[model samples]
Target chain A: MTAGPVLKGAADRVLAAPAAPRRKGHPGAYLRWLLLFAGGLIMVAPLVWMLSASFKFSYELYDLNLIPVEPTLRNYEKVLGDPRFLRWFGNSFLIATIVTMSNLFFDSLVGYTLCKFRFPGRTLIFIAILSTLMIPTEMLVIPWYVMSQKFGWLDSYWGIMFPGMMTAFGTFLMKQFFESVPDDFLEAARIDGLNEFQIWWSVAMPLVRPALAALAIFVFLGNWTAFLWPLIVTNSVEMYTIPVGLKTFAVEQNVDWEMVMTGAAIATLPTLVIFLIFQRFIIRGVVMAGLKG
Target chain B: MADLALHGLTKTFGKTKVLHGIDLAVQDGEFVVFVGPSGCGKSTTLRIIAGLEDATAGTVEIGGRVVNNLEPKDRDIAMVFQNYALYPHMTVRKNIGFGLRTSRLSRAEKAARIAEVAGVLGMTDLLDRRPSQLSGGQRQRVAIGRAMVRDPKVFLFDEPLSNLDAQLRTQMRLEIKKLHKQVGTTIIFVTHDQVEAMTLADRIVIMKDGVIQQVGTPSEVFNAPANVFVARFIGAPAMNLLPGSWREGGVALDMGGQIALPGRQLADGTRVDLGIRPTDLAISADGAGQITGAITLVEPLGAESMLYIDAGGVEIIAACPGRTAPDPGQQIRLSADPEALHLFDATTGEALR
Candidate 1:
């Protein structure tokens, strides 16, 4: 009460007023909402079809309706009942988890080094690493295969993960984020009696959490849904990841499309959850990366 | 805790030399201030002493041992940066105790040390807050506390108060001086603000163009500057320097006045500059003064006023009593005691006697 007048100043009142109402009354707003809703339907149609198909029987596959009239749990039953399906799911989980962990650790370490340390040829080395991003993955797939064969890593977890253990894109992302950490903080840490590694780990790393979270989500989702490298290197049924294992549903003569859709629907869950949880970071990280570049 | 000395300290970034052979000896528990204009290498000299930067050629000795090749941590020093550099993600308590991460102190001892420092800095309640939540002054206190917790041989402050507003800067300046008094640790503070240098230093090292111009106590530098640059830099409103040539009984001013040098004799045509503080120059109502000038501007400061006068072709600033200052366009005679004048060699700019 003592400071009531001051607290209720005209400027404060103006600022405390509610944000402008949504422009729903305008024709432009109506057009924008209509267009956005149409685009949303187009993007989500395939996902809706997949979900719809997962509930239908093989005979009902040709139906164009989004909701099946004869929906049954039999497709899920057949997909879950198979032992090989579970093995493939587990394999994908293991490979994706390991690959994501390795990328996060090695990429951030190399990024911190390339960004913070001063040494001869540092710029050249960073350039060399970044130059790899220019090379097409298809061009290097044969070499990756040859290297895996030479190391006897074919049909193994290491073969699927070796190429992605560290990536140029991840390194570039981490370095761009590390650039925001002040050199003064590092100097203060050094004067505080911290070694270079300690400074990087404690002071430098914590400051770029948003970048790290964004990187983690990107790597995790990329590996989780990865098809090309995993499909190429892995040979045996036991080693096939979800994407490769899902292919087994389509035989030479008869393609079990319903079962395939069921597996895909289940595989989509983890990535969807992850994306939902960290959607804001992804948007922020992308905008920041574009601005910084 | 340590007397520090720099011998032939020099730094070069590629072809540009930043610090050129800086030499000074700081006594144990002495508070020394490095004051200079920007690009004058005051911060660079501080960085080299803290070992954050490598001197191109010099040896830094702390407590009589060369620490040229030692890491900053190994050099037994702590630095407070201009940006504070407090870890944004860490709480104030953690930020202050960070230096102790490498110390062998027990957990309880480290906490106690942090608590004591926080108490001294009056940041006990704010210890749980992050730097983002703190005001500018509080963040500065956290930075000082972080440096204090180390209790190293010397404390290095690189223009630590430059980021604060004018009011906060003065308050923090007093706190830092009182802190030095209580802790009695050797401190090397770098600032371009002359007031900070004058009010806080036991000895002020004034530098220009990467070279130390004068190193002396506040009073010594204010009263008897080593050179023309020091004379102008150490005081507010700057000292008035007039170009002239030596004559028989005195120096004849180039702007139409002659100031007598009673007992000294010099070459008749030697070029010299006569320096006088604004405080020493007074307006003469009787028209019997060394130089006469028309007042162009009057800036009052409550108790005193600064008069910008045009004496012939030269501009001079004189301090006058605020209430007694005459209006602009009034012609006035300015006078100063011959004993209070400073004479510098015009060519070299070095003080003579």
Candidate 2:
């Protein structure tokens, strides 16, 4: 058993720790992941807090803890059981859906005309529409209110939906997308005996599906979370959207945090569900638009 | 199936005119190629005929009907694009049948036409594949198949084979020619490739700077160019131009030499340019010929060798048979066939004979 010098040397080296200088993790990579994780937490924290608050009683809201001491469905029960809350939810859903559908149709129509047709003032009209994107909603709120009042549309669905439907942004997005569509494709369709309308409807619309989906989600979200316009126009409780309906729950005497969180959660759900269903198209549309731009 | 006539067609974008007033008639089942450099308005003229772009002034007639105000579809013509603009989402079969389906055709009829076109283009197995899934050549075949299925009065191709690889381009070129022969449809092709134009066209319309330079058969343009531009543009490796002056009913080279021409009589001291193709120059072992020069470079192609010889203070390229190899710096005497020589006026670049 001459396991003397060689074995001893091997064992000593194997038992020795940290022979080479240990390298540290890259600070930039660690910072990047840290910032990403922090962003993830910051984005999800509010939604988590809202969901937790919705399932808690009014007393637990004041406790100010991450986890509820005693979780209950009492707030949701109150929010969902109320007939006004249900009606507001229905009203908001209906208005947003109608606005989204109309925006998809009308914006694409105007977009197609501006993109493909050779009529007089087409460029002028397109420039005019694009300029509207610069004017904020706050600037036009007074005029919009006056118009709604003049049209006798106060507290009506039309009042809430009219100003939001057929947005300049939707038309602009569609026009940009349609412009990138190779002219040869449209010409080929035309040579195939497809008229202008048929070309737009059958060929252009289907090709721009991702753009239309993106526009739909944007319009729906804008309409669903609309506060200022809906607030100014609607006076009747029956015509109240969820945001306006939630304001009624808040008073000088007492602010119902649980009910407010419940309403916020309800208002955010439709947009989230829509994003989930068309998430693939929305991401593709954004990337395509970015690359083309 | 139908003839097309472009009567005094012209187009202008803003104030810069792109196409001068031009007239051309494409006979039934004839293939006409518009060949030119970029900005030559070949594509613009084709687009105008297709009704995609309206001409600023002119009338386009197809099948004896003046279709100046009619839409592209009403003109009953189909076009194959350079990018092979097949619908990305549609399969080859659907892409081919799209036009038929849009018309008053039954489902069975559309299917039959699709099958017929697919068979003609050898795309039967590829009918179910999307354009993205097909190769470049396959997509080109599909584009042609799409055009064929329409059975239009005229077929318009806007550089359809330009996007393919060299090998595929050559292959598709033959396929398109064969397809045209089989279908017997009037086709107007636009390309900047001179070889494509020379090989495919029954009549080649050479254009430059938005104007027609010449219209002739391949040999006619090659042998009897209307001007120096046609002579320089028609031949590969280009025609060799040498400066000379008229001397005693013969052209006297600036390098102290003269060649006799029997019928060509020009004013004495009139400067002219002698145009000779590389293939027209013959290299003989006898040094007592017309011109002598030192070979500067020798390019040995498989079948023929191109000799760049320095003669008469100018470099002339001579294409000779590959069997005779000449070393660089070798003195070579080259004599061109007198009948093949083209003389152009030095001032106007117009033919002198």
Candidate 1 residues B188-237, lDDT tens each? 99999999999999999999999999999999999999999999999998
Q: lDDT score, residue A36, model 2?
A: 95
Q: Per-residue lDDT tens digits of candidate 2, residues A1-293?
A: 01122223333444444355544597876887799999999999999998888878887786668678888877888889999999999999899999999999999999888988888999899899989989999999999999988889888999988887798888887887787677788888888888888888877787777688888888888888899999999999999999989998886368998899988888788889998998765665555445444
The lDDT leader among the candidates is 1
lDDT of 2 at B128: 90
The i-RMS of candidate 1 is 10.0
TM-score of chain A of each: 0.87, 0.86
TM-score of each: 0.93, 0.91
Every model's DockQ? 0.41, 0.27
Model 1, residue A7: C-alpha shift (Å): 32
Error of 2 at A213 (Å): 2.0
